[model samples]
Each structure stands twice: as C-alpha cells, then as structure tokens.
Target: MNRAVIVAAKRTPIGKVGGILKDFEPDMLASFVIESLLHETKVSKEEINDVILGNVVGPGGNIARLAALTAGLPYHVPGVTVDRQCGSGLEAVNLAARLVQAGAGDIYLAGGVESTSRAPWKVEKPTSLYREAPHIFTRARFSTEEIGDPEMGEAAENVAEKYNISKDKQDLYSLKSHQKAVKAMESGRYLEELVPVHLLTRTGEKMVIAEDECPRKNTTIEKLSKLKPVFRENGTVTAGNACPINDGAALVLIMSERKCRELGLVPKLCFIDSAAAGVDPNFLGIGPVPAVTKLLNRTGLSMIDIDLVEFNEAFASQVLASLQLLNIPEEKVNVSGGALALGHPYGASGAVLVTRLMIEMKQKKARYGLATLGIGGGLGLASLFERIEE
Candidate 1:
C-alpha cells in the first residue's frame, strides 16, 4: 500500500450549542473549514478526487457532496457521507487514507461537521417489523429497540456503574480537563489549527467566534462537587463532568506521499496506522481500550513511545476508565484537553482532535501522535500519524 500523508488539517473554533455558531447550518460550517484549508495550503480544489463528511443528525443529505459544491469544487468530484456517531470524523479520515493507499485516489478531503443547536427533533417511524404486525405497534411505544432507549447520558451512567468509576474521580478528571484547556488557550497553543468562524449576529451584525467556548476557565473542584448528576438523581455523571453540546467542523487533506511531492506540497505527517474496535453498547465509553491496544500491537509500538494522545472526553469517568485500562500516561494524554473542555461536536470531534494533535506534535517536535475517540454505538476509532521532517 502507498503511504498516505496529511498535507494540512484545520478546524473551526468549537462553539457551544446555541452559542456563537448557531446561525450557520452544518453544511455551511463544513464548507467554511474546507475552503479555509484550501486557501491556507494553496491547494487547488481541482486536485481533490473525493470528499467524505461525517454527520450525526439532521435530515439526510449528501453533506459531503453539498459541502464540496458550496466550497466551489467541481460537481464531478465524488463525495460520501458517513456516520459512526462520535467516531464519524475519524472514520472518514481512515477511509480517505485507505483510498490513497489503495491507489484509487491521489487526493481527498475527509472530516465532519455538526450543528447541535439545529439538530432536528426527529420522530420515530414505524419499523418494518411493526408494519408487518400492526398489533405490535399499538402494544408498544415503538417497534425498534434503537428508538425506545434512553439518552446518551443514561447510557454513560450505565457504563459508570459497570466500570465501578466513582463520582469524585469523574469530577476531578473533569476539573483537570478544564484547567489544562484553559492553560492551553492562555498559551495560544491552539491558534495554529483553529480557524476563526465568522457568523452573523442576531442584529444582522457580523462577528467572529475564535476561541473554544466550552471550557470553564473559572471552574473549580468545589463548584463541580456541588453539581447534581444529570442522568440519574444519584448517578455519577453530571453536567459539569460530561461533554457539552457543541457546534463545529473539522477537515484534513490526505494524499499519497508521491502525489504530495508531485504537487509540491509539504507533508506535515504520514499516516502510519489506523484501527477501529467494538464493545458492548451499554459501555460504549470504554470502546477505546481495545481500539488503542489493537493499534499499538499492530504497529509493534508501546504506549510510552507515543509522544501525544488525543482521546475524546465523552464523559470524565469514561475518559479516566479508558486511560486506566489502556495504561496510558496521564500527562501525555490530551495535553490540550479533550472534548470535556473543547466541546464535542459529534461528527466533527474525531477530525477536530486529529487536527489538534497534529498541531501539538509540530509544536512539541514530536515524531508520533495518536488521535482516538469512543463512539456512541459501542465503537472506537483511532489513527496514528508520524510527523514528517520538512
């Protein structure tokens, strides 16, 4: 297989739901990031062979194709939209790498976008099984097992109970996440990859949302301790410890090493390996344990050799559990903070983390970085990148 290399990766500043970026639609937000990447890298739109987008909510549309068209790319450029829940963006990136490695495409764009503020409240439809047996639909609220369940928060609480993660530990981890995020923002370490998002205000005024809005700079452990659990009255997961609803878009340019050199583009990093794994749906948050272990074992590398790690913070308890199970060093993980502080934009989270990891690796002069995320449906995805010398 040909080595796939990342030429550039960038993301819009993550905005809280109903916050700075609420005015823009998901596709529009995704297009802005795609256009920014093209302009920043000076890469021609015609060079891209495909565009893959990940999205979790809203009416089904060819989001990838729409984003490319909106960004002024050729209509003929092939596009695909994928949904792996929180891992969608990373899955898109992984697919793009496979395409390049397989010699099917020389250049591709892969990423994800979500507008939780505008997420549609979809109504459950009668399942085929229900239709076949009309009496069943009347007897039960819904025919599908998928639709009759509780929200993700409840599922997270279930994981907490199963893993025996304590509420205090979760709160401590959540507090630490905010602290590290605030530190990173103060240090201006995220400026390289974060593109300022421009949007229209309610009064028809223009504004820019440049900084991550989820991180509570003033958050204290004492304040976190006082918060009540949201999913269950006595559950461990709380609003302060769980990922906030957010809006954002993120993308990366992937191409074969030979193709990048031919186009005179500097290779920022070469994709070394990628993997995905599955776990019990009820304990979806723990999916990353097996995923990262598989990737490390496949590549013959140990956790200590990894210079940087970006693990999505779905919930503080889940993040801590995954880290403990995987035996990852606490200091090296989420050096810029994870989704708990940065905001998880569902489909956009995986790509956002990948872009952030790349920027951190460049700044730290690190050789290797890993971007990983736990999905909502018992799935985990991970990608390994090796910094290429300029």
Candidate 2:
C-alpha cells in the first residue's frame, strides 16, 4: 500500500454564464489548468499516467480524453470522465487517491470542468406521429422515479424548512459569504491559485479574464432581502442566496509519496480520508453531515481537529442548516468564501473548493482541513486533507 499527496492545484477564474469563458470549451478549460499544473510542477508529460475529469453537462464524448489530446499529452496517457453532479470533482480526486493507495498508479491528474454557457440544449428525439415541441433539458435525470429527483432549488427549500432555518439567517450567511470573498479577493488571496485566461474576441481584440465574475462588491443583507424567492412562493431560497450558473475548470496533481520524492515535488497536503453518503432526495443539503461524520470516523478525528472546512454553499440555507446540525461554527467553515460568492460551476465546484482549502490551510499552517459538498440528488462527498508539516 502507498499514500497519495497533493502536489499541485489550479483553476480558471469562474465566469458567469454567457460571460468571459463562454467561448471556451469545457475540454479546453480543463486542459488549460492541467497544462498549468504540469508547467508549475515542472513535471514531464510522460510522468502523467492518467487524466480524470468531472463534468456535469456538455457534449458527452469523454471530455477528459478530448482535453488530453488538446493539451498535447502522449497517447499512452488516457482519460476518464465522471459525473457525480457537484461532487464529481472531489470524487475524482478521491478515486485517484484510492488508486494510488492501492499501488495502481504513481502519478495522476484529476479535477473538473463545466461550461454552462456552452452546454447544449438537449431535446429528446420526437416521433413522427408525436406533437409539436421537444422537451429541452440539458441536465440528466438524477435517479429512478421512485427515488425522486427534485429540482436542486426545491431540495434547498426542503433543507431550510425541514431544519427550521429562517430566511433572515440564510440572508445573514449570504451577506457574510460575499463579505469574506470580497475581502479575500481584495487581499489577492485568489491570485495564488488562479490561472489567468486569455480570450481572443471576435473583432480581433485580446481579452484577459483574471478574476471571478460572480462576487458582488456592493452585496448587502438589505439587497438580498428585497429579492424574491426563486424555488417556491414565499420560500426562503432566493437568487441572491443560491449559486449562479457558472463556467470554470480546476485540476490537481495527486502522486504517491514515492513519485513525489522521485520528482522532487514538495507535497502540500496528504490524503487522510474520504467518504460519500446519501439521503432522501428532498433534503439533499443535509447530505454533507453524514459524509463528514463518516470521514471523521475513518480518520479517528473530531471537528476540533479540523482547522478549516469548505462546505459548498449551494444555498445559504443548506449550508447553515448543515453547520447547525453538525455543531460546526460558521467561522471555521469557508473562511474565505464559498459557492454562493464564487458561483458554482456544478462539477468543477468541488475541486475549486478543495483548492480553496489547500491554499488557506497552507497559509494558516493548519493541521487538518475538510473539503465537502452535497450533490444534486441526495449524495454528499467529503475529503480530509492534512497539511504537510515542514
């Protein structure tokens, strides 16, 4: 058996739907970060044994393989794509770790990419005898009809009502998320991990997209309160509190300890444990609690031992409810911000959140950190990272 460690992590600045990254393919976005990691770590292309990417919606021909070809990796480096909705990215990393731990591979590249702007409108094929319009929906079904696959916003609402979380509390958490993200951006915290994206405009102009386009500098609780609920009439969930449709990509290099030493790459974080759990589809937001509990149990650690946490803020109510149920402090989680402030790009968000924890944990010299997120259909994924003590 072997151990896996994180040697590199990087992401493109998240773009709002129909925004800066709209023209880029999800495969291209993924390749950009993977190439950046290879360059940053000075790792040879031949050293990469596999490329695994997580993606939610797009043209579905194994985007990871497309990325590998686009990035000019050799033919021997194959790619695999996984879809666990929002948990896909972290789950890719988790699977990579397992492979390394089982002595299957020495080096691997795993992460996620999403191009909401480019996701094609999927319409079911119409029979010649059938009626006029085809139902166009890009997202795939969550589960069997008996299990139920409620819309994500509806699940957030269920989480809020089921846990008795109030609208005011949700708004408060949203405000703080914006505040923290704004502060982190102003302080250049994201620059360390951001890979600047370059775009050539239609009119022969060069455009540079460097910062996340979602966080609002003027966001306030008052403004959020004035917004109408989106999921249900009189519901606590609102456009301002839930994640926006976003486009982005992120990648991390995980290598066995032997491979790290062989390449002279300094590992920043080591994999401690990872787990997944599921719940009733309606209350999907609470999924993380059980996933984290399982992860903690595996690591034989407590919340007190976790110096930082990144709970994807799919909805403010969802995050708040989970924190309350788990007895975790808000201050300990998403210290720099979360999906609410940064925009959630579905599959890419999990890896992006993990990158956030890695940077913060290293800066704070924290002992342990947990990165976790709930999926759209009752699933949650959690991964524990231990800072490499210098």
Candidate 3:
C-alpha cells in the first residue's frame, strides 16, 4: 500500500483535424510530449518503470513502446498501450496509479495520444464471396448489433431528446464554452502546461505551433443558431455544438508518494480514486452520471465536495444532460472551457481533461477536482484528485 501522486503534466496544443498538427504522426506527437515531460521533470530515463499510452486509431502496433523508443528512452524500459476509446488516456493514468498503489512500480509515465489526420483507414476483409473488396470502417464497434449501436452524434441527440435538453440551451452553453476558452487563452492560463510543437513543413520551413487552434474569439450565438442539425432530421445536435475532430497528445508523470519525497519533488495532486460504468448505447452521452455516482459512493463524497469539474464536452447537449442529472452546477464545470471549445482528440481528450483539472485546481486553490468523460460506445470514466496543500 503505497500512495500514487501526479508530479507533472504536459500536453501539446490541440490542432484541428488536418490543421496545424496534421504533419506530425501520432508517435511523433507522443514522443514530443514524452521528451518534454522528461526534460521538465529532470527525471532520468532509467528511473521510468514503464510508459503506458492510449491510442484510438493509429497503425495497429504498441504505440507506447514506439513512442518511448522514439523519445530515446533506454531499451530496458518497457511500454504498454491501452484502448478504451475516448476514455483511453484517463484509464491509462488510472492504471498507473493502481500499479503504484500495488507497489508494482515507483515511477511511471502514462497518458494518451491521437492524430485523426494520421490514423490509418481501417478496412475489414469482405465476408461475402460476392464482394471481394475490403469494407472500410470509420471506428470500432462499441457493442454488438443486438444491443444497438448509434453514431456518436446521434447518441447525443437521443440524450437531448430523452432529457428534454433544448436546442437553445445547448447553443447557449456552447457559446459560453467558446467564450471561456478564449478568455483562458488570452490570459495565458494554458501556457504553463502546454508544450510547443515543432514542425518542418513541406516547403522546408521550420514552424512552431504553440497555441490551440480551436478556440474562436469571435463566436456568437446568432451564428450558432443559424447552423443546421447534423445528426438526425430536425435534431438538436449540430457541428456547432459538438466537438470537432482534433489532433494532440497529453502525458502525466506519476510516482509513488515516497518516491516524490525521495526525489525532493512536491506533488501537485494526489490520485484519490477512479470509477467506470456502462450504459445503454442509445444514450451513450449519459455515461458520466453512473460513473461519477459510483465514484462518489466509493469515496464517500458528494458533488458539493468537488471544487472543480472537467467533464468532456463531447456535445453540448450530452454535457448538459449529464450535469443536470448529476446535480452539478454548470458554472463549476469546464470553467475554462472544454472539448467543445478546445476540440476533442479522441484518445487524448481524457488525459487532456485530467491535465486541465490538475492545473486549474492549483490556480483556483481548490481542494478537490474531478475529471470525467463519456465514451463513444456507452462507457464513462471518472477520476478524482485532491490538491496537495503547499
């Protein structure tokens, strides 16, 4: 029984799909963060017990190992990759903490990475003899056909309809998300934890991407109201309310509390506990309700006990529905914006939430922070962290 704590966290600026980060491969993006984390923490590669990462749609190899080697870590260090879809990154960090608590590792690097622009197009072998061509799949199935599977956007629409979340409310919430994110960016709230990404363009010029590409400083509700629904006919879900496909990577340095003391490093946040839950695929966006409930029950805490919440805003409708059901005030969630404004880089988004939660809890001088997100295929993952009193 050892305690696990997060001593450092860093992430690259999120880029819109086929935008600033499109040139970098998924492994390259991950390697940059790995190198930056090692440099920032001044931790030797030999001390790393393992490197774990979550990846959604990369070339089907163990990317954690690939990125670790690419970052020039010693060959002796091992790496493993996990895939829980959108929750992959947060789950990776949770796994690291559990390993630390079990006395299995002293120091670990865990997080997630995703490059929608670079993800390979998956093609399944043709099952019928009549069709020899391989069939393409945009994503993996969350459940079997018997249980019902819906597109992420369609699922959000279902939640909105079932929960009576209005289109106007969703648009208003989305507008505020953009406003808050723009404010945070302008005030340099995101600068300290962001790692600048360096790129070499096809024109042979060097470029450095240091700012997030998703936040819009001039977004307006009038503009949002004019947009048409994208998921269902007369549906409330729209591109304006849903997170855009994005590219980025985030990583955290986790170590046992004793190891932090030995290294003379003060941890910013202590890993309290984690929980996960499954729900009906049709209302996939409501996944966070049960997961957060389970977490509260396990920790003997309530929503009022949390000072800050970083719930992934996959869609304004889904976020609104889940928060309302959980009795979490809208003002306490995503105070500096969320995936709606920052963009959602699939596997990397969960780790990004945790990264924001840690930094924000420190800035606000808060005690408890919760990072949670609804998965694509009816799953939700939540992690609770307590800020260390300095």
The TM-scores, one per candidate, come to 0.92, 0.98, 0.98
Ranking by lDDT: 3, 2, 1
Error of 3 at 144 (Å): 1.9
Q: Estimate the lDDT of model 2.
A: 0.90
Q: How far off is residue 11 in model 1, in Å?
A: 0.6
**TM-score preference between candidates 1 and 2, better one:** 2
* True lDDT of residue 298, candidate 3: 98
lDDT, candidate 1, equals 0.86
Of 2 and 3, the candidate ranking higher by TM-score:
3
Instruction: Specify the poorest-scoring 10-residue window by lDDT in model 2.
Output: 129-138
lDDT values for all models: 0.86, 0.90, 0.93
Model 1 agreement with the true structure over 1-390: per-residue lDDT tens digits: 899999999999888989888878888889988899999878788879999989887446878888888888987887899988889899999999988999999899998999988886654555675565333221112113663343577778887887788999999998898999999999998888888887677799888788988889899999999999998988989999999989999999999999899978898988888989988676778888889999999999988889999999989878888888988888888887888999999999999988988888888889989999877767788889999988
Cα lDDT tens digits, model 2, 69-163, are 99999999999999998999998898888899999898999999999999988888878546767878756777668877788898899889989
Best-performing candidate as measured by lDDT: 3
- After superposition, the stretches of candidate 2 with alpha carbons farther than 4 Å from their true spots are 127-132
Model 1's C-alpha root-mean-square deviation from the true structure amounts to 3.8
Best by TM-score: 3
